[model samples]
Target: MNVSNLLKYCALSMAIGIAIVPNANAITPDDQLVIGMSMDNLLSLDPAAASGLDVVGVNSNLYDMLIELAPKDPSQISPAVAQSWTISDDGTRITFKLRDDVTFHSGNKLTAQDVAWSLQRVLKLNLALASTWKTYGFTADNVDQVVQAIDDYTLEITLPEITDPKLVLYTLGSSPSAFIVDRKEALKHEVDGDLAHTWLTTNVAGSGPFQLQNWRAKDRVLMNRFDDYWREPSEMKRIVMRHMTESQSLRLMLQRGDIDVAMGMSIPDIEALKQDSHIRTEANTRGTLYYVAVSMKDPKFANKKVREAVRYLIDYQGINESIMPNYGVLHQRPVKSGLPATLPGPGYALNVEKAKTLLAEAGYPEGFQTSIRVLSQLPFINIATNVQSTLAQAGINAEIITGTGNQVYGAMRERNFEMLVGRGGGGIEPHPHSSLRSLVYNPDNSDEAKLTNFQGWRTAFYSPDINSIIDTALLEKDAKKQIKMYQDVQNLYDTQIGAIFPISQMVDTVLIRSDVKHYEGHQAATTRLREVTKER
Candidate 1:
């Protein structure tokens, strides 16, 4: 049979509505984009507090950063609200020249003060996104003094410590915390001294292409195109993001033309759709990693030999081949793949006998029982099941505990979990430090530090040596020396058997209608909808 005939045959066999009469729920093309994906991790819309890829995608359309990492080439920085910027010879200060033409959705003129205040709000609030700035030595006390507006269209930032100016620039262009908020509008709704923290949870004060019409938590988010946008208005008249958790439902909706885009679909469903002529799948590899982490607070896991045993228990080859297709590729390193500084993975493979011997050496010859906290979603649950099976071979009985993103990660944030199957580590910025900062560099190991932003801290895994290496690497001016220093950090991490073991590098796959034009998925999760349009 021809490809078209096969598609029809397959659709008819499945009795999908698209083969006959479309469902009433099917959306008709009206210059609007309808997307289906899970919103469980979308806890906060406030740029300072929002913590997941869902909110990052949402905020991309709702706010504009000073600069942007070009979607086409993330290595290249693209100007947005800021027209141009210059770094001081000492590499301690950066001055940005703002565009005079930009205005917020509230019709307030975008200015340097707005940029300064928006950045300051992050440190002042000290929320989830403040970790990055804090690492750069900016604090609530120093923020006002360092990040200031020299004039209405000129913003200046003085780094509180000696570090790469590019890191700060990358943070400004890519981090959601760097997105500029309308200072005047936010202050108008400020309750007490929150800087509109409460209001911004569900509202927006941005200069991006779309304005939030309504955001019903865990249900749907509706946004309309901002007609007075600085650039060409979004081709989409409105964007509707329906809160969908089921991959099967998303696949069905996409097959029936009910939604223009579907994210977070199951591998089987995604593979099934590849034959459908009307749909196409786009896979974008992000900087994040899917890792199996252990808390060092647990005496059993704190042992270096035990950590190595746990590493040997993972079936890296099997998982990447059978379980990680369309999800991720085998990457057994802290830093993500493809970066110039990122060394090849240590090439650790699953060796059940080796794990058994290591366990015996660690005085766990009979193995032990533990619990693994994992997100209750596709890829995660599947990966956990595989890990559980492999761990059982080494006599480690791990009870699988599943929950939503908030539940699983919240436990990790509280330093309350024994083991976890999770995905994290920054990939938004092109810099190698991005991943190391999130996954390896832990300045504080004490629980009192409450440095929940760093997964390294969350795992209670700290090496002063590793931290020092990272600090020195960031300040190194020579390109070759910096790369060598990063490699040395990874070598030390492997030798020390860090608490977190990378299994695979993340690859986000989304299915979209063939006619959905200009929908580019970003490695940073900041996929913009401004230029997206539907041919139908």
Candidate 2:
């Protein structure tokens, strides 16, 4: 577990397709930040296509967004490339004045044109991240008109719909699709008029603090500091992010001082790390929620009484206490905690006898059989097993189906599942509408509508009243009234017994060496490494 021994393991891990560094004197160098994490989902460097937190962390460093969520307070916004901005009284347009000193890593001066093009490309390409923009009534065909560069330093965005402009601002600040790319440099590598989409998948073009040296999929990512960065230069000359998925191995590496930071570790390993004098563990609660969802497409779940019975069947307190130690905290409300509009937990507890009685009342004296789809991971698989045991108590024969995120959530997205234990609902923006829109806003319910992005639609759980309330709450300019409207929505959902029942709000934990300074994790997952340093 020594530094030299850990380096040898690193060399072996990189033997396949990664370049081996020679004469590596130190594992945790003062001027280099070494991170250990699972890069399985770090599939693309392309901002338009990247989907997970892994990519968000990488892109946040390699690219610049107009604005960023304040590191200390995610609810507040801070300036990045756009130093100043103004919103119209009508709440339809926003004008941004780009900072004059920024320049892309490629030496081209960063301008508002690049910003406009970057946002437009996301919609035109219509990739994974484009859905966020599409929700704001932006379309591929009209993106150029919607997002226009007024001049070299000025950009204007006109919303097609009457929505809260704060949501759009939050999207610009946090969404991966909002990262500004060097338009000229990207177009230089274009293939078949793709706007360098294919090239960007593996490479980067931005004016951020770090420049990607090389990225070996599922291996490691190497980034060198950009000395010409507009802001204070990054203290670390280089960042080496090694793809280590095993929690014990990461624990060993950290214990030996081989890695400066370790993320996505198991709860047991995380607990063990808490006892280490040289390592510190930090948990930042995110906006996303973990919930048990039932597809109303299933006749059994379509019944409100059955839905209520299923709610009573869940041991929310038990699961949150035993299984969700480092993963999440108890949160029953649909909207995430810490928001003005958010309501208190409804305190739904396990009532097996009541669930059984309700099952009988729902015309099922004998509990029916169903399958629970869940991701084959620590907390998810564990939650599903617990749910299975509880469901059996009420004579419900529940089979646990485990698979990868794609296999499990894809079934939910296609509305092809009976029941599912999943984690989602966009909470990154710190806006109440962000979570509500993703979790419960089902604008359309027809099978042909195919609004797969919304979990409400995916579960075939459509409530016109809930949808109308959400819409009104978003547009409610009066702050106090908006808060009241959101609370009312939660109350209505409680009485209606919605298909998706939230169990906990997610909390992401990371273990860093005690000497690592200024390395705060962002709740939005866009943790910038520019200010990070290590004390030798």
Pick the lDDT winner: 1
* TM-scores of all predicted structures: 0.94, 0.91
**Where does the lowest 10-residue lDDT sum fall in candidate 2?**
16-25
How many angstroms is residue 291 displaced in model 2 relative to the true structure, after the best TM-score fit? 1.4
Runs in model 1 deviating more than 4 A are 1-27
lDDT of 1 at 444: 86
Query: Which regions of candidate 2 are displaced past 4 Å?
Result: 1-26, 188-195, 447-450
| Clashing pairs for predicted structure model 1, backbone only | none
Looking at candidate 1, what is the lDDT of residue 354?
Answer: 95
Q: How accurate is candidate 1 locally (lDDT)?
A: 0.89
After superposition on all C-alphas, the RMSD of every candidate to the true structure, in Å, is 4.3, 3.3
